[model samples]
Target: MPSHERFRTRREKMLGQLRELFLAEGFASFSIGDLAERFRCSRSTLYAVAPSKEQIVVATVRSYFKTGAERIEARVAASADPAQQLAIYLESVASELQPASATFFADLADFGPANEVYQENTQYAARRVQDLVTQGVKVGVLRPVHASFVGAAVAEVMGSIQRGAIQEATGLDSAQAYRHLADLVMTSLADPKKPAHERRAT
Candidate 1:
């Protein structure tokens, strides 16, 4: 590859490694020197990724969420059923977030730039849930409930989860909380008059 291509490839690799490190141990405690040592690279090399520790954390967090959203969408796209789509979306989100340690979330909340990325992702998730709910109702798989209302409620719960309130209140981690939310949404949308198999489809 050309020199620029080589640099890009190495940078991408470094970002992926940094993302995993942050997810497992959080970023707030790691300085640029620490990260450089961890990666066996010079400070200048790390600086190529970002100018400072905070910027690096922000970039890695953003990259992690971006990759997660793409994966979740791909999983949801594989299922044709509207109800299954909703389930897959939420479950996929949980699965994607399962590797993140509590420390990582705490650090994310403490960092303004990183927290902004997280907040934006949460907002997008709320909108996606609303769209899925609307689709389910249109196809008669779900009851004719108000999609926007359901979306808003899910958004509130999601915000609470992101802020550590859900963990404090229920002793459930973010991933487990999402799974429960998926179950709750599916159960509430199931039509009682339908046959068991049909209901199960939802």
Candidate 2:
């Protein structure tokens, strides 16, 4: 393999371990020294992938969300049924975020750069969601409401959920909150002509 590809492969391997650690223990507690000791790698090896601890955190979070968006979009495009696509896309989002802990998100909110990465992803997500809703409306699977309004509202709620507001309002954790949100949105947006059983199953 080429040197760059080899390096990227190594970095992705290391990032998998780091992402698990961050999700389980939170990002605020670990330092480069701690990471090196925990992962059984030298400081130079860690530095080769991420020059600093904050950069590592940002990169890990970005990777997690980026891959999640890709999977959700692919699922959305997999079917011709608009109702099914909506269900799959939203439910996929909940599944993707189910592993994150409160502490992991709290740290992201406090870290400006990492938080910006999140914001950018959320903006992209909003656009994707809007497009899906528009398609649904065009096909008559969803009600004719303003697509921008629905998309923006859902994205705002998701942002609040990430910031731990959902946990504060309800005793549910982030993952549970996402599941509930997906259910609620799907129920409201699902085509009335579709059988209830089908919508629920989707």
Candidate 3:
């Protein structure tokens, strides 16, 4: 007689539990054993989805970027003005960075090392931003700057705003930092619907 299986749909259940755990714990100090125990599975079961702990962390980061990209797309779709859409998109990113874990940040600190999956996800996020800028430019809704340059500038400004926000949500620095940077970046990227001064006044 063949042995019976105790856990049907195990992979889905495990992955679901993994997502939940990631959201709750924010990807700090995680391991396959913890996931296995959470899902009541053997450690070997984790190897099926991820080869190492770093792979699991990278996957979690990828998951975050993927969901974040979806939200940005939805926000962009709902907005009319290309400038407003870009501002909203950038500000949304600054806001989103607040909930990320320190461990996630630490993992990212090592991202420049020779890590394929990690690098891939980071590049994917950057490419998404560049692609959006490229589309806006092609449609004549954005300035003709290089997409890569604009994307890098956007990332840098957003990071600055996020760091400033992390300090305290008071004073003009916190309340208006990201907004101000968004205005600067978007004004430069906006279409020729209005004069530069008028767009800046916005």
Candidate 4:
């Protein structure tokens, strides 16, 4: 491989290990030297991916969520029904977030760059939900609630969840909180007269 490809390959390999560590222990609990030791590599190797510990954390967070977005998109595309597509999207997100601890999310919320990735992801999801709502309403599966209002509400709830407010109030971790959020959105949008299978949870 070329030199740059070799470097990219090595960085990705190290980041895979780092992602697992962050999920297991939370990013706030580790330092550069700590990560180096955990990976059984020199501090220089860690620095190869990022100039400092903070940047490494940001990079790891980006990588985790980027992969998550791909998975969610794939699952959403697999379904033909709007409600099923929305449910699959939300469930995929919940699964991706199942490993996040309170501390991990707390750190993510406080960090600017890392938080932006999360915010973008949430916005994209909200847009998707809005589109699904529009589709379902047209198809008579969802009630004629304002799609924009519901989309914005879901985004607000997601913002609260990212900031730990939801977890603080409900004692739900990120994954559980997202599941409840999905349920709320689906229940609110589902047309009562629709078939039971259409309203069933994913």
Candidate 5:
């Protein structure tokens, strides 16, 4: 391979490693030098990923969430049932977030650019949930509850989760909170006239 190709591959690998490190331990405390040392790479090599530590954090965080969203959507797409899609969506989100430590969430909230990425992702998630709920209602699988109202309520709860308010009030991390949200949403959408076992099968 050419030198540039090798460098590109190495940089991509470094970004993946850095993302895992940040997810496990948070990015707020890692200086460029510290990251370089930890990765056993030169400062210039680290600069290949981003121009600065802050930018690196932003890039990594953005990539993490972006990849996670794609995976979640892929899972949702595989399931044909709208009701199942709603449950799968939220559960997939929880799974994607399971690796992130509390410190990572704290750092994400503290940092402006990284926090923006997180907030944007959360907003998209809220909208996706709303779409799923709408689909469920259209298919006559869910109760005829107002989709717009459900969307707004989900948006508020998601925003609170992003801001750490949910954690403060419920003692649940983002992943666990999302699981509970899945349960709550599914319960609310369940058709009352359906037998309990029938509802569970959906």
Candidate 6:
């Protein structure tokens, strides 16, 4: 049984440790020496996988968005209506990211992600929006808006929902904002005149 233990590569172990540190403290401006202390490994070991702190930060943010996209995808699949699917996807994404403090967001306020990992995750999310919008347009659920425009609009709303909702709440917290976001998305995307097949084709 000793030799039958589950297998994991050194790279996987390093990634896991990196994830663990992220969960415990969130994003920090840590040097290789700092990560070395956290992982109890040589600085060379940390640098072996992530050569720079920027790489590590980008990797962590990529992980965040990838996890968020997966959550939204699940929500979309579970919903019966295209409208509802778009709403659920938006609300769920906001719900997932609401815990991330605004400090990191403020720091990277204008910094567009340059890493391919983050870009790929973003494209995946965008494709989901495209599907939702195209379905809405096909079904007459939403008005005849360009799918690209609608997708971009939904993406913006999803990012802005936390701020929008929080400002409206007295003591309601973020849950109310997410709920409001879902409702608004449904209102915007639902096309009652079109059939499921036509929309699905989209």
TM-score of each predicted structure versus truth? 0.95, 0.93, 0.57, 0.90, 0.93, 0.61
Q: What is the TM-score of candidate 1?
A: 0.95
C-alpha displacement of 20 in model 5, angstroms? Answer: 0.6
User: Pick by TM-score: which candidate is best?
Assistant: 1
Worst 10 residues of 5 by lDDT: 193-202
lDDT of 5 at 154: 91
Whole-structure CA lDDT of model 4: 0.83
Expressed as tens digits, the lDDT of each residue in 93-158 for candidate 5 is: 989999999999999999999999998998898899899889989999899888988988999998
Cα deviation in Å at residue 145, candidate 6? Answer: 5.2
lDDT per residue for candidate 3 within 36-78, as digits (tens), equals: 7777778877765567766665665555656666886787778
What local distance difference test score does each model get?
0.90, 0.82, 0.59, 0.83, 0.89, 0.59
Q: Candidate 1 regions off by >4 Å?
A: 193-202
| Distance from true location, Cα of 193 in model 3, Å | 8.4
Q: Lowest summed-lDDT stretch of 10 residues in model 1? A: 193-202
Encode model 2's per-residue lDDT on 105-151: one tens digit a residue. 78888999888988887777767778878988998888787999988
Q: List ranges where model 5 is wrong by over 4 Å.
A: 1-8, 195-202
Provide backbone clash counts, one per model.
Answer: 0, 0, 0, 0, 0, 3
Best-fitting candidate, measured by lDDT? 1
After superposition on all CA atoms, what RMSD does each candidate show versus the true structure? 1.6, 1.6, 6.5, 1.8, 1.9, 6.3
**Pairs clashing within candidate 2:** none
Between candidates 4 and 6, the one scoring higher on TM-score is 4
Model 4 spans > 4 angstroms off:
none
